[model samples]
Target: MNTAWIYLILAGLCEIGWAFGLKYSEGFSKLWPSVITVVVMILSFVLLAQAMKTLPLGTAYASWTGIGAVGTAILGIVLLGEPRDAVRLICIGLIIAGVLGLKFLAKE
Candidate 1:
């Protein structure tokens, strides 16, 4: 809703991008994917730092990681043929709940 939150969300998205880039990069062996991964990784950290300027450190960090973990897991399932068992889905749902709680219930 605010600029800091926006930055955090964008950072989370960048986190996801970099995660995929890491896979595509093949352990940094690929040129373009590795470069893109590094760039996105830097962007993610910068945006996260910007968010931390206003957000409480715990909330910001947890929410940022929560978004990244959830996004990456879902994408892994969809794109990389990862498992999609009920337990895994349930765990992901719990993570989503925790992230939403941090966003809406956090004082700042």
Candidate 2:
């Protein structure tokens, strides 16, 4: 509900965007995708910094990366036709659990 949390969530989503953009950019060979990726990457860092002003450093960083990893992995499976095996899904679930645990345990 806090603004810091919102910023953190948005930063996570931007992290996902940049990750996809990096893939589409093909090592920056593609102009537009590379530009977008750079912009989104900056935005993600800015938002993460904003959240860090309120959140504990460890909690904010871990949660941000966890969100990006989980989101990117799921999207990769759906959009990019990546693997959908049980072990992978279970691993993703574990990451989600860890992120949620960090969130709940965080004092702020």
Candidate 3:
């Protein structure tokens, strides 16, 4: 697998952590978790910038946001009991397709 892909995956995981952290932060009163969450989000963005060094900026950014949005939405549904309606599912599918399409275009 490409290093860029690995970085992107790491970025995605960081997004999940950061998204959860924002909820758990409780106005940033919980020191440790809040700090960790901020740090992880910063690191994720840094990794994203690094990945962009090789990948096209538009492609990298779009994929990063797409994955993060989809991941965070799924997390909200599973962990926070957010609704998982058909429209939301369709939107997620479209996001995934957009990410894949960008990747494929980059390969050409």
All candidates' lDDT scores? 0.96, 0.96, 0.86
Per-residue alpha-carbon lDDT of candidate 1 for residues 63-104, written as tens digits (9 for 90 to 100): 999999999999999999999999999999999999999999
Q: Candidate 1 — worst ten consecutive residues by lDDT sum?
A: 99-108
RMSD in angstroms between candidate 1 and the native structure over all alpha carbons: 0.7
TM-score of 2: 0.97
| lDDT-better candidate, 2 vs 3 | 2
Q: Tens digits of per-residue lDDT for model 2 on 1-108?
A: 789889999999999999999999999999999999999999999999999998999999999999999999999999999999999999999999998888886677
Model 3: colliding residue pairs: none
Best candidate according to lDDT: 1
Runs with alpha carbons beyond 4 Å of true place in candidate 1 = none
Return the TM-score for each candidate structure.
0.97, 0.97, 0.91
Backbone clashes in model 2, listed as residue pairs: none
Residue 22, candidate 2: C-alpha displacement in angstroms: 0.3
lDDT of 1: 0.96
Of 1 and 3, which scores higher on TM-score?
1
**Cα lDDT tens digits for candidate 3, 1-108:** 578877877887788789789889887889988999999999899888778878878788888888889999998999889999999999999999999888775672
Q: Which stretches of candidate 2 lie over 4 Å from their true place?
A: none
